[model samples]
Target: MRITRIETFLVPPRWLFVRIETDNGIVGWGEPVVEGRSETVRTAVEQLAELLLGKDPLRIEDHWQVMTKGSFYRGGPILASAVSGLDQALWDIAGKHLGVPVHQLLGGHVRDRIRMYGWVGGDEPAEIADSICAQLDVGLTAVKMNASGRMHPIGSVGEIDGVVERVAAARDVLGPHRDVAVDFHGRFTLANARRVAPLLEPLRPFFIEEPVVPENSHLIGQLTRSTSIPVATGERLYSRQEFLPVLQAGIAVAQPDLSHAGGITEVRKIASLAEIFDVQLAPHCPLGPLALAACLQVGFATPNYLIQEQSIGIHYNQGAEVLDYVLDKTPLKFVNGHIERLTGPGLGIEIDEQAVRSADKNGHAWRSPLWRHDDGSYAEW
Candidate 1:
């Protein structure tokens, strides 16, 4: 069916949702946001709509190649995120039209249930213990926490010890049974990453995320060689080309965001590329329902899939939660630390259209927290 109209809704708690409608009255939904840059991504999606209007929604592959490469200046977070949401909507429409799930179209299910992890707030030892306990109460077997917040570029030895102590506290609470993943958040420099890696190795964190920013990805190989802990990154990477260097860096896990990294179309290919290196695929999804649904679709079909990240009670969801705008929470209900395979057609979850449209009326302009050191030098958050 021909695409009739494409609509975008800027929802609260920093999210942008895209809806694609066809001549046959079938509609598909997707989440296309870059955390704080929802309005910018929405504008990018609006511009990309010119290329997709009146085109057949079923031609997913062709449209993907064009939307991603047609523009000479392409493949940034904004452009790729716009294409990501559109590609998700197209896949959602394709699955619904065929009366099957996206994973079924991708190949068949490899696992009956996909393991998921929750994000715990980065606070003091007591607060960290409380948050980890809370997540465990809800049946989460694995939880991730930020190692440190607003770290200095060259932190002192005491600060390094504090960072390790924070993680060690979580390990103590988890009791060597449940998994604990530590997020470096790209705040640590190469030297800091190296210094902390050996200390954290003793605790055996699930993985160290973004030890440094993507710009310093060449150093990832050195860091990976130094530490036995797995290295995972790529929420900012936008395409297969961007992922090639990181995979070649000997990283053990590749974390591509379904909403940021060209959606299912490119992420599925990214998973294949990582598979060649024997790396695991753990999607970085901390957004709305449609994005998580799209991530699960890929996780179900991908062979090297490791785990999925969902923002159910993540600190980012202030006024809005994951299930608030979703009509079918059954597809997302966590049980025994894993989400059972969704049998519904199209991304396997239904979006509440009325809630979305109403939220868009008073859309939000959310921005990431900007931090600074004591001397006013800028610091990563």
Candidate 2:
């Protein structure tokens, strides 16, 4: 069927949703946002719609190649995220048209269920234990927390101790059976990460995420070698080419965000590339339901898949939540820390069109938080 209409919705709590409608009465939805820069990515999506309007909806690869290479000045968060959402919509359409799930089209399921992890706010160490316990109350066996908020470039003894204390608190609550992953969140410099990673090694964290920002990925190998903790990154890295260096840098887990890293089309290839390095796939998804569903589709089909990062009760969802826009929450629910295979077509979860339209009426202007050190200089948040 030919794509007849394309629409984007700026929903609450910082999310951008795109809907693609085909002439034969089928509609597919995708989330294409760059967290705080939804409007810019929305504009990019509108522009990319020009390439897909009146074209075959199932030609996902051709559309991907053109949307990515169609512009000479290509490949950044804005463009990659734009292509990501549209790519998700195209794959959704393909699955619906073929009457199968997206993972089936990708070569069927590799596992019956996918493991998932939830977020627990660790910016404040006081709440780390309580937040992790709250996640456990909801049946999540694993949880991820930030290493620190607005950490000093060269952390003091206190800052390093605080990071350890926070993780220790989480580990105390989770005990030995459950898992805890620490997120550096691009807030640490290479030196600080190197110093702090070793301390967390005693706790045996599931992984240390984004030990350094994407720009400093060249130094990640050193961090990985110095510590026994598994290193995971790629939430900021946007393509297979961009991920190649980090994969070669000796990461043990690759955390590509389906919403940011060229959607399923490119992330599947990224997973394959990481497989050659003997790394595990743990798709980073802290957005909305569509993004999570897309990640699950890939996770169920990918052989090296480790775990999935979802934002169900994440602190980011202020005015909305992951299940708010879905018609059926069954497909998205977690069972014993794992999400059972999704059987529905496309992304599997049917979005509430009415709820989405209503939410878009009062769209949000969410922006990332700005942080500064005690001396009033800039700091990562």
For each candidate, what TM-score against the reference?
A: 0.99, 0.99
Per-residue lDDT tens digits of candidate 2, residues 1-381?
799999999999899999999999999999999999999999999999999999998889999999999988999999999999999999999999989999999999999999889999886666987898788888999999999888999999999999999999999999999999999999999999999988998999999999898998999999988999999999999999998998888999998899999999999999999999999999899999999999999988999999999999888999999999999999988899999999999989899999999999999999999988989999998
Candidate 1's C-alpha runs over 4 A off are: none
Residue range 259-284, candidate 1, lDDT tens digits: 99999999999999999999999999
- Cand. 1 Cα-lDDT: 0.93
TM-score of 2: 0.99
Cα deviation at 295, candidate 2, in Å, is 0.3
Question: What C-alpha lDDT, on a 0 to 100 scale, does residue 355 get in candidate 2?
Answer: 98
Candidate 1: C-alpha RMSD to true structure equals: 0.7
Error of 1 at 324 (Å): 0.5
Angstrom error of the Cα, residue 23, model 1: value is: 0.8
* Model 2 bad stretches (over 4 Å): none
TM-score of 1: 0.99
